[model samples]
Target: MKKQLCILLAAFLSAALLCACSGKKPAEPVPAVSAAPDVTSAPDDSGNDPAATDKPSVPVDTSYNPETDADNLYSSANTILIETEDGFYWCSSTSDYLLFYDNWLEEMIPVCSRPECEHFPDNNVCVQNKKCDAYLEAARHPALYNGKIYYIDSNGIPNPNVDGTRLGMRLFRMNPDGTGKEFIKNLFTPGYEDPQWLIFHRGYIYGMSPQTIIEQGEVSGRTSIIAIPIEGDETTFRTIYEIDNQGWGCMRFIGDYCYFWIHYMEGYYYVNWDTGEIIDEQQMGGVALRWNTVTEEIEILYQELLPKDGYFGETAWVERDGTIYVPGGDCLMKIENGERTVVFEFKEEGKHFVAATVSNGIVFARTVPEDFDDPYGKSEFWVCRFDGTTIFKGELPMDWFYESPEFEGLRGKPRYPGFVMTVGDETGLWIEFGAHWRSTGYNEPSADFLVRYDFTEDGGIEYKLYGSYDDIFIEPVD
Candidate 1:
């Protein structure tokens, strides 16, 4: 399931690709998605396959809330509902860089929104919906920081190579009510493809866009993360991080530092936001996932998963109290005062688990789907109180569907979510989704399709698709 990832670029920039090519070291077993256009033999599983190894399986919380909140979901949930002081903040991403993965991000976004579903109905996915249009996908992970909901603009058009004109993606700013539709920066340039992510830090928005280079006229190499000013003109954009001869394995900004892990065959390097540092070039040593600076300490957490070669390990996480709460992954180890009691079962192989940020003392963990090997598909979510006593397994809203930004018909979308935080205000959540169609295949239907579903039914399940593409419009959900 490897797909293309788009990074937004703010300035007209280029990097010097002049690595000696001789001093490169051998690769360790870090999980990486290759640039290959198609799927390869399953690289390393993120944290499942119990029979292969005996790790404590993720605790299965069988909580159910079927009538209202579909706790036992089977398919897509476009609007990721989050509780808040004002109301529920629906988290989502929309961007055009999705063309790289054949709509993978478009497909994946729905998964994050709903998580659990027996199976998503065919032709029901927003990107390829029968008649629905106005489907917006994510350019970068949607960020909730300092009580502001941040996302980039869906300004890009089909790539000229893919289409005929070189349409580009731009960054956008909006208040929670979808009010502030302003162009923070124009991310389209001749050399830079698109910017996909936006991270807020020190009152500035940091983002990354990888420049595509055709090696030997076809092979792809190198990826980089650039920075954008959340409050300035486009000219002042800064490309804070870059890596040579590697792919962007994972990127996230924790607190003041922006973390980018570049995974290469020989291993990976950690690109730090603070001090403009790229110094930590550690051999992955076969540890799953790269430069996992997601936690407070990188080296300590790395060795714990590894400990030794003959053993394999995995670690799962939950950000609580500003400190990353990693239970365990490949190998089993515990640190930090009795807080994280990582046991053997907490190891990767046996238990399959997925978690979101903990709020109000409850950590939300989604169960793995049964049909697909990937738990990400057709799964359900459960709330496990961090106190270590109760798990509230329940269903999400009904009739929800998910698709990645790359999904056909979906222009901007990315799946790896940024973060979910409940603000002080409680919200009346309406997981609004469905798209407006542009046209029929090939000819490019001009019809714009738009539809929506409200979980609480404040607005009944009213939607439209399969008509003139021009008819599509995102009418405000009341």
Candidate 2:
């Protein structure tokens, strides 16, 4: 009996050891987790349509009183709203664009102020009975470069921050205030990709990406330099040039005969968009050739935008004082005398802007941490001056994308600004594509529609409620 008792005690001790082994220091408390980060959803579709409510006609007061309708202002949710029939940002109207934010759905208002409104093509395109609705995305602080509001299609075709579904982005055009819209139908074949290389300039919009859209099994190569006329909806587009298997990034115009680019993703490869010919292919180098209309030929200039060791990634090239400028991994480069000069040095590695542009004397750049959930450093923006001065260092709220510990699921995402473009000194344009994403909430729009913060006599304003500026978007004005 004593022997039996000893064996039982030994078994008990073993069991106790097993239990202790599984405990694991209590798991460091496992901080509460959330679904993915996304804004809340709009309350509900309560549009005051005549067929539904048939209430007395009430005109939208355009008194410019922020104190009365502060909630509608995009400063908190969307400062402006665009009204159209297709739901959000749709239609071929490229003038008289309206911008506005309503109860929850940030609106892309359509303007009927033009003579063409009386005979709008889309008005009767819905067939004899079926109705074709109009939609428009908001275009605040719109910029009219070539008879069209310079805008980008912020469709989340390839949002890299999340998995499962990839959100894609494209460029588009609209009226200055948000009336007319001419969709830039991207020639995306089945397996096509832009690699985030698109920009608008000199009456034409251009970019390059990989594709399998048309000739599916044909090597998946044949990258091309596509050019779309800036003449609105009726504008014809064609593939100006094609590359067998070259990757593309940001591009800059050199002159009538030349264009320049930094392949970015893998190595350095530049192509002349005008000729669709690669100027050169080198594993490592700095001197670049940019063609300026005024100069008329490819000129040798120094470019420090490419990283000798690490990948230079994507960039936005802008012309300033007849010189070319760009932002890269940890520095900003100026291409002047056929050599790159590091005008500004980024403080930290992996902390850089995905895109940039130049307007006035300030260097408008969008800097993000290479690691989305970067733990060691700031994860938001690194806006800097041409002289490398950080003017607006507003913190980006991307943390809402991840939730851990408690559930550890993606919050999906609350709808937020799809793209950000600076129109002027203080005003910027924000686009919401009526984008409904998937997440912890099971496929749905963001939870919080309009974020309410400080309450004035009119309404309160809140931006975080929409989501962080950089999180809800990918790149480009589109």
Candidate 3:
């Protein structure tokens, strides 16, 4: 009896210990995790014609006014919205209404003038049918070009922060308003993974797919750069370049060639798009590069190294009139003949310019103060001519509630602008003010706000807030 009682006590203590050990800490911030990371999911494909399917249409609530209720626009929910290539502040319609992905209702809602309209895929009277259907589980990464719209259609999986199963991705296309829905091809190939890069360039679609190569029964990974001609058959996929052990390289077509790197902050391979010939391969030793049309060669322009604590990252590159500008150690620098000169710098020693963008013959530089209390720093937006002539400088017309929290003895990310790009004459910025650290093994929650900055002729800038969403990437249609 004494032996049995001791055994039972030991078993109970072991069970309690196991339960306590299973509790996990919050996930680390993104960019500190794996070199290659994946985003969200869509809905399952039924293969039925979206128009032929029958479903009741639900009327979207169009009562929210941004101009009046702008202060009350804070929500912790994940909603999707669409932005045009031109960034003209209106959806692709005549009613001047903005289109949004209603999260709770699982349908596309609009702010159009029509009151009796329904936005479901089966409803023929819905106005959004020409641009997007209600049946789309998740349609994202929109690339508009040549009278057609291209996007990734997914299986509407939840928890877009971490990668779920590859339920298959459909590369679909339609008209500007959403009519003439046509299936392009399935992006998912058996045994391949991490379809992260996609762009339309010069009458063709460029993309990268990471494939697991099984060699001698051992598994390895390889990233394949593929090109699909827009006019050619969708079934015909061609490989432009293939590299092994490369992770998340930025690919861009600046001028006469396509520029990309195999790994981060390494050398670049410049290739002529017309012919699959490697024009030049050179190491930049920096985060980004630019094509010098005068010298007919590429130059490593920007190289901003973050601190050792992994709090912040490098900003986007800005180019104008064949000249490139980037954020450097403490100032904005312009690259000339592989040499960088200070284009603009802050007088304060603690302040640093990190993000640079160009639009309408003007270069915009975003700065932040590094006082440790606000390591993410102040969002001071400055504008200048392409020749580095400073014009306008002021703080952005917005306030922050709370920034990302600093871990124990580790730095945290303050409010900072992630991607700054110019779409037509207007500039679009993706800003993150608050980030909730995940309790699981993943990173921070995938949420960010989009802001549009319109620079007027009088040199005054206008700001427009586009709400928040989870991992929505907006691009200008070429």
Candidate 4:
């Protein structure tokens, strides 16, 4: 069951397994996909899951249709979509209209010229179909700059018959409205690797190459941080940094710096983007360090054991201003000048922090009851002021797969919204929400439900659900 969920949510699995080391916490008890989602575990008869609850008398409405819905405030029908400064874009698995939401008019505009044609089978429009010579499969990891959008045009799986030089993933750029699309460059040569991270800054794109084995038959692979010239040929892209690829971790680029880590045991690093220089490094040693990206400095914010014990806890941390807040263990705490101050401690015996973030003077956290013992338990969302005053705390009514009572035991975990792109003072979260599952596995090949959480609302957070897409990438408008 654990393996199956990892594959189901491969994008978030890295943090699922080693989030203790990374500052980013989980928003739900949903276990990360360590591998492909196809792996399954034995059925458990004991109802020890925290996330499970009796079927409620009133079922939450989780579905929406973009085609019929006219309201701009709320819509549930369109899935696999993204919103940028320019407009909102959604790629459908069924429809021919590669949809775009006009930011100015506040309406969805279909970009395809062929009124009768389903835009998918024909890649002439927004999507990268199987028919194209480069054979663009799906668009992933999008970034926006100037007036154009850049993303990973993932070619399908490797073909042994194809030449090595021609194989590997490609970066693509296009207009925000899904016009003037073109390939940028192949991510790697003569080998295959998926990007763990992608960032567009200062007229260049930075990506961390996928892990490769240290040696043939060895488990781990060598990893590298790559930089691509936005306007240059493939030769213009270069490997800025390289290290042993620690499987099941992540690298993130913010401003002009990059934060990197592989797993709990391997430690972490802060690198300078402009010079490809190592700014600082820290070993977890059972301790998690908080880097103040704003101040360009690092601090040891949380430790599992006392200095005498010299150990670290699995707790998670987030930074704002110069203070570090941790929301794991029994109590949530704020660390200042090496002092631990209690903020909001969990009175409940079993719940702990799954994920958290601080933006615009507000702290948003997701927690789950630990008593259930199941990897994914019922999750609660908490919103509070930076001072630790609670604003709102309630169950995050997100059930990705609507499982019947008979199949309740086979339900999937509650997943984190993967794409949390902070735009100025506002924050947007994009991730797969609901699931359509069958006896064998997921009912659909791709995520059926794409949910967006808009934390920029005046009163509180607002979310919209979109469904049934081959692939989707959302980026904040520049």
lDDT score for residue 376 of model 3: 43
Every candidate's lDDT: 0.31, 0.34, 0.38, 0.39
lDDT of 3 by residue, 133-209 (tens): 32333322344444455566554333222243445556666544444568766554323445455555444455556
The candidate 4 region of ten consecutive residues with least summed lDDT is: 19-28
lDDT of 4 by residue, 226-261 (tens): 555455554223544444433333333332233333
CA error at residue 219 for candidate 2, angstroms = 5.6
Clash count for each candidate, listed in order shown: 108, 87, 11, 31
Q: What is the lDDT of residue 335 in candidate 2?
A: 58
In candidate 2, residue 217 scores what lDDT? 58
Answer with 1 or 4, whichever has the higher lDDT: 4
TM-score of 3: 0.48
Off by over 4 Å in 1: 1-84, 91-151, 154-168, 174-181, 188-195, 208-213, 217-223, 245-344, 347-478
Query: What TM-score fits each model?
Result: 0.40, 0.41, 0.48, 0.52
Better of 2 and 3 by TM-score: 3
The model with the greatest TM-score is 4
Q: How should the candidates be ordered by TM-score, best one leading? A: 4, 3, 2, 1
Prediction 1 global C-alpha lDDT = 0.31
Which regions of candidate 3 are displaced past 4 Å?
1-140, 154-168, 188-193, 208-224, 234-237, 242-251, 254-347, 355-378, 399-448, 455-460, 466-478
Question: Please, what are the lDDT tens digits per residue for candidate 2 over residues 359-474?
Answer: 33344455544442233234344445577866554444433333211112224533332233231111222223222344555333221122222212222212323321112221
